[model samples]
Target: MSKVLSKEFLQRWAPLIVLFSLCIIVSIINPNFLSVRNFARLATSSAAPLMLAIGVTFIIIMGSIDLSMEGVMAFCGASLAVVMLQFNSFVEWGFLAIPVAIVFGVAIGFVNGLIHVKLKIPSFLVSLGIGFSCIGLTMVMTGGVRVSASDKAFRLLLTERFFGFPLMVYVAFAALLLAYFIQKKTALGRNLYAIGGGEELAHASGVKVERVRIIAFALAGAFYALGAMFAVAQIGSVASNLGTGFMFVSITSVVVGGTALMGGIGGVWQTLVGVLIVAVISNGMVLVGLPTYIQEGVLGVLVILAVALATNRKAIQLVK
Candidate 1:
């Protein structure tokens, strides 16, 4: 009875406790950690990665991984930049250009899904390939050149205040709200969790696992493209390496947010917390004077600890 109670307590409260503890520690380390400016920066810094994490959250919960995000983001960002650049025919696309970029993203995602489902390819291998292809596509688009947006209206988003925060911050919150709704109220969302809990059982229970998987991936792709677009907007430019290092950080945010690696657990709320934590850590380190070289290692060790605590390992028959 005690053991069961302890397990329940850990499952319900451990991650939140750790998150608060981390926040307290960081705050103590840097007295100015709670400043409004710092939080605004955290929101903006987290915006793109938060979207990427949300994109992959469904896949991860369905017991699959997406390693293609960085590539997809770079490719999508480069594509959008190329479309909006002043020097090309594509530049004349006007406001309709955003939809074009989104459609392009859906295409990439659809291909990733179709190929994975039809061929039974492992997501890890397939996503990595997709990612590399995206990077290559970006390279082909740019030939080692950077394209900056000249649109003041678009670029103004990074600094434009909406209520008390930047416009992009509200956009991020809207994405979060939409994700939460999908997770809580949609058949597709419930199907995703069921599939994660047990793919074989889900298959037997009348769930169209393949179809749902494909939709999930395609949705993920759309979000990734949106993230890339926002990222480009934030920086006002795009390059072949636009999405470099994202997979690691976004995955870390997801895992650290208490999503189990083995799937069937975690959600958007956890992911939001995780993204904020990661952003706070990045900001706090600079405030507290921590060296850049050590931050990755620190985050890595934290990730391992987070994974161990988040996963209910004793129930698993195997680890692979």
Candidate 2:
């Protein structure tokens, strides 16, 4: 019994343990990697990707993928930029623009979900197409140029620190709490797990699989929009490439956190840890004098290895 318990504990916390060990090793190699200032920078830099990972976590829990994060974020960021910057004679409302971006995110996500569920299309292709379409729209709207905003209050949300922590960290903490409540206290969350376990069984068991899926995707979209807002607020500008690499990074974080790509398991807490691990690795690499290109290669290799270790190969057979 003791051995079984030990094994269970190891399985659950192995990723976190490894992550911390890596941090320690990196700090030893470069003392700057453990500085307080660097820690603050790491937290702020990770805020956007952390939110994106949380969003994708929902879709993964529903046994689906959302490759549309980049597009959704780009659209949201672009919309916020145009609205607040008065791009086309549109009136600017300081804080109100945030909700408008979120709404557009939900609408786009709903359309993506509709295409996947109603049209019986795979989410990968559907999301890819939709993401490209959003990019095109952004280019057209901004004429392939950057959009800048001058809202000082809006910028403070991303720039200001409370008790030595960026305001975005507080927002991420709130989002994490909300995700936890949804996963543990809501019927929709249970239904999502059931669907992920077995879609046909869930359908036969009276779960509104389609509705749950659609809602999950929509929520994911909203989160992506929120992340985009953070990006814009932090930088005080928006660009077409604002979300270009987010989809890959977010998915990588979720998978590294021990969330099975096959779904029906894991939660926001795991994702938070995973995001921290990834953030530390990236930050540490720079401190250790590794070139940016080499760091990317290392990240790719680490992602592949982490996924292999986290996956339960015996429980779920590879479909392809």
Clashes of each: 0, 0
Question: In model 2, how large is the Cα lDDT of residue 272?
Answer: 91
In angstroms, the error of model 1 at 9 is 2.5
Tens digits of per-residue lDDT, candidate 2, 63-109, equal 78889889889889989888776533234455678889999999998
lDDT (10s digit) by residue, model 1, range 1-320 = 79766976776666677778877988898868778777787788899999999988888999899999999998888777777764343335544556767777778888888889999999878999999998888888889798776566666667688755788888888988998999889999999999999999999999999999999898888888888878988998888888988888888888888787788888888888888788878887888898866767877997898888777667889877
**After superposing candidate 2, which stretches have Cα over 4 Å from the reference?**
1-8, 87-92, 316-318
List candidate 1 stretches off by more than 4 Å: 1-5, 86-93
* Candidate with the greatest lDDT versus the true structure: 2
RMSD per model, one decimal: 2.4, 2.3
lDDT, residue 55, model 1: 87
Give the Cα lDDT of each candidate.
0.84, 0.84
Superposed Cα deviation of residue 297, candidate 1 (Å): 2.0
